[model samples]
Target: MLKLREKLLLNTALLALVLILQLAGLMKGINTKVDSLLPSPSPSLLSVLTAFGGDVFLIAFSLLTVLLDVRNSGKLSRETLVFLVSAVIGLVIVGVLKVAINEPRPRNHGGFSFPSGHTYRGAIIAVYASNRWKRATPLAVLFALGVAMTRLLLHVHWFGDVLFSLLLAPWVYSIVKATQDSWLPLYRRVISRLGLGAFDVE
Candidate 1:
């Protein structure tokens, strides 16, 4: 069973990546390419995501979450809840920044252009699956990266926006994981009282 602290430790590598990219003038070339990938909105598969905005992918990601949760280990219940909380925290962080910066979408739709919400949520679920299904690590990472690519292909977000998927989501997930861990005592107590710890996800 993966402990919450161990799960948080697993993300240290990703956090290092974020630290590097977040610095000004760091990875300029990669950043520019990321921004360039946000295509003009239209009927193209890529543009369609943008045309419809982010709602479509959000729903799709939710489905991914449910599927992964069902397939994951019982010990991951805390981590699973953490991932959900992180997704919301990421959304809220983006929303606050977007409104404060008043950074309109490329075509002025709405949303800050710094970090893409689609990428963040996609990354969280991807990490969730990868960690829980260790045998499928590469595939899980690829799936997450693919989601980031889709965001760029559809012009729903810029390259940097997609890049944030790997960059920021780890930190957000850690925050949620830590918060959840803080309440583990209560959870164990509740489980002990209900004797549900013996139950499994199926």
Candidate 2:
């Protein structure tokens, strides 16, 4: 018994499934192009978006999400925590894998090339959209996809890097949601102990 809105959203999500699946082609030079024609994010735009610092946009967005929770009287949205935790988990997983595997980047790159951070961030943004604006999920996802494309076109990261993040976003989000559901009381306790009483919420 799905409402029209839910049905429409489900349909769109299905389409996203297809496209995201297809992006796997670029994950590890797996049927990928050494000379992909895809345009990268514009240099100026890259300068703007990638400026600040390590995951600057992410930090800003994460902080904003936290502030929004405060404004909402400490009632952190399940979606908000999911998005943040997913991104963080993705980062941590990448680090763990990098160290354990000692995986090298695509030669001459600054970091490992398995999963792309840009693509992962893009996917994370889409995860956040799912909780906040389900109807606009597709568009938000496209923007993230665009960021992945920019990374390749600009040659900052390799295909595998882009592919990894693309794959990681949704998975991390699910993990975050599951983890949050299982640990709400813990979250509540931590918040209570933080002396955020006025801003405390579930």
Candidate 3:
């Protein structure tokens, strides 16, 4: 397992690289070239898959996963809370960056698109799921990649947007994991005192 400091350093470096690329005016060229290569042959199919990365879908999925884990284990694990909390934080960060940077989407779309929210959600979910089930890592990765590709195919985001979102996943997970480890005991005590101890799984 990676420490929180290492994860932070890695993500910070990647973010710096993205900023440098943007400053050098290379993101546009890269986005245009990549978009040109991926023509949308089946919009409906890709759209359906892309929806899996959306806020509604991801939140619902997370809730369902937590419920299922509770059903099976008779307790809510720290992992579930970590996943949910990290996802919410990631979304907030992306939203704030979108507003602050005010980067426009591809093809004259109105909203900011410096970092793809759908891609970020997809990557975060993939990382969380893979951590829970190691055997599913490949599938999770493919799902994340597919979600990122759909954004380009649909011309909703630039290549740099999706790339950065993808890179942010493990970093978010690592941070959340570390936070959970540090705070779960206190959280458990509070919940247990309130008679909701079933959620106190370590």
Candidate 4:
């Protein structure tokens, strides 16, 4: 298994490369080319797929996964808490980046679009699922890719935006994993003191 530190370093390098491409205007050219290859709009089907990528859908999925994990183990697992925390961190980072970059959407939808939130959500869920359940990795990856493709097909996000978000997922997960051992005990202690020890994993 790859260590968390190794994963973090790899993802950070890839993110830096993507950012450099975006800043150099190369990502725009790439996005245009990729968009040109997509089929004409099929709003009905595209809408359904796009909905799967939404924050609401991802949050529900995360909750469902947590419930299932707890049910199976008969206790809240550290993995579940880590997954939730990673998702929140990813969202905050993406929100901040959107404000800082302030890139426009491909369809002129009037908001920052350097990184697609939907894509990020999909990728983050996929990473969380894959890490928690090794057997689900392939399906999780396909689902994430499908969501990324939907952004391009809908013309709501540039190719680079989706790509960057996809990379952001594993990067965020790695950060959480690398620090989890050090901080989780502290977190558990705080929760216990707050009368929330029921949620803490054994």
Candidate 4, 1-202: lDDT as tens digits: 8776777888899999998998788888888888778776877999899888897798789778767866777557877787788888988988998998888987577888888899988998889889888999999999999999988888888889999999998888888877898988898888789887547775
Segments of candidate 3 deviating more than 4 angstroms: 1-8, 23-25, 189-195
lDDT of 3 at 187: 75
What is candidate 3's CA lDDT for residue 86?
84
Q: Candidate 2 local accuracy as lDDT?
A: 0.64
Query: lDDT tens digits, residues 101-146, model 3?
Result: 7788988978999789999999999988888889999999998999
Is candidate 2 or 4 superior in TM-score?
4
Q: Identify the candidate with maximal TM-score.
A: 4
Native RMSD of candidate 3 (Å): 2.5
What C-alpha lDDT values do all the predictions have?
0.61, 0.64, 0.84, 0.85
In angstroms, the error of model 3 at 171 is 0.9
| Residue range 109-168, candidate 2, lDDT tens digits | 576655566677767876687568889888887777777766776666666566556666
Residue 87 CA error for candidate 4 (Å)?
Answer: 0.3
| Worst lDDT 10-window in candidate 1 | 46-55
Ten residues in sequence with the least summed lDDT for candidate 3: 19-28
Q: How large an RMSD does model 1 have?
A: 6.0
- What TM-score does candidate 1 get on C-alpha atoms? 0.61
What tens digits encode model 1's per-residue C-alpha lDDT throughout 129-150? 6766788888867766776776
Which one is best on lDDT? 4
In model 4, residue pairs whose N, Cα or C atoms come closer than 3 Å (at least 3 residues apart or on different chains), thus clashing, are none
The count of residue-pair clashes in candidate 4 stands at 0
